[model samples]
Target: MSNTVVNSAGAGLVRAVPALVGAAGFALVYLVSGSISSAFASSPAPQPNVSGEETRAWLIENATASAVQAVLMLVSVAFLALFVGAVAAITRSADGPARRWAIAAGTAAVASMIISAVLSLLVGGLAAGLTPDAVVALRTANFIAGGTAHVALFGLFALAASRIPGMSRPVRIFAIVVAVIAVGSLASLAIYYASILILAGRLLGMVWCVFAAISLARRLKQFPPA
Candidate 1:
């Protein structure tokens, strides 16, 4: 390849650095949030079908922690959004289905976060004023948005990344698996025990992001300008 092509590829890799950082940030912040919330809790948080009074008391008692968790989630979502946009740019520069797939993935990724984001703000900022019944309702909605729905839509990103023409076999296969786990997590909506799928998809998606970003950088470096 010519020096010009090499330089272009190098520039692409540099531009991709944000996506790498964003992916890492998304995972790290989310982990920290979970850890902090768990650390402060005296008992396991209430689940769906728990009494509204019990849920309300739990929220009120943990109001500060809930706010902190919400703030962290917002930050993580911002990082994930950055990752989606940056990766989409990289895919758009490549040939084949990558471009279209990335766009769809990016769209889904952002859309998935909207409900979670809005609900987070409400839970964090308005928990004190919420009725017991409202607490139960919001809590369920929060779980659905941040848990199942988020990962289900995020699976599209993994699926799209898997299609990038020159991605390594392992990364592509892993991305596909992550996508399946993530998209399949939708089953949890009906079969409550299947929430394990949501957990797997959410956590594995982070790992996939890191690997995919590295693979994307490597692929960009290897390919020359047409």
Candidate 2:
């Protein structure tokens, strides 16, 4: 029993690592980007009429911060992918279909991360020195890419959680609902008030991370020692 407890704890810690890292990275990005956006929102500069404009303002305010956030986002995605993979490996017996979904979801997340990273580099560079028009174009591109990637991550997380053996179905369903909100918000980013939707999605995402951490810890408690 002691061995089982120890093994479970180790496994849980390993499984929880990705979610924890992702949550931390997301918080960093949200806080830094949010601060930047709030500063710009108070500025006299004309707001860019694009999706995630407020968030983009923060990225434009500081090139280094933008780069850092982009990298952090990528790292977060990698961890999320790992979390999904771990879930699939651990819960193959409960639902094979869910496991496959988890794998595919992880793949989508990784792809989105890669795309976002490249776009961030391009946009961050352009924002460093450019005319208003050029900045608008770069900002538009960043919004589209970032929004899409975020939606993908949320969707995958929801799907994977639903399939995991020990997770409550209600929690899984809530995750799915959050994913839908995220995807909807992303789709509406071009609209004026869509940022609110995106913001809501991010809030839901944070909640999901908490849930994931708890679920993973519980799973770890059940593992046999290696």
Candidate 2's C-alpha runs over 4 A off are 1-62, 127-134, 187-190, 220-226
Candidate 1 ranges beyond 4 A from true positions: 1-12, 39-43, 95-98, 222-226
Q: Highest TM-score: give the candidate number.
A: 1
Q: What is the Å distance of residue 158 in model 2 from its true position?
A: 1.1
TM-score of each: 0.86, 0.68
Error of 2 at 168 (Å): 1.7
The positional error of residue 180 in candidate 1, measured at the CA in angstroms, is 1.6
- The alpha-carbon root-mean-square deviation between model 1 and the true structure, to one decimal in Å, is 2.9
- In model 2, pairs of residues that clash are 8-220
Candidates' C-alpha lDDT = 0.78, 0.61
Candidate 2 lDDT over 65-112, as tens digits, reads 556557666665665565555555555556656656766766675676
Model 2 clashes, total count: 1
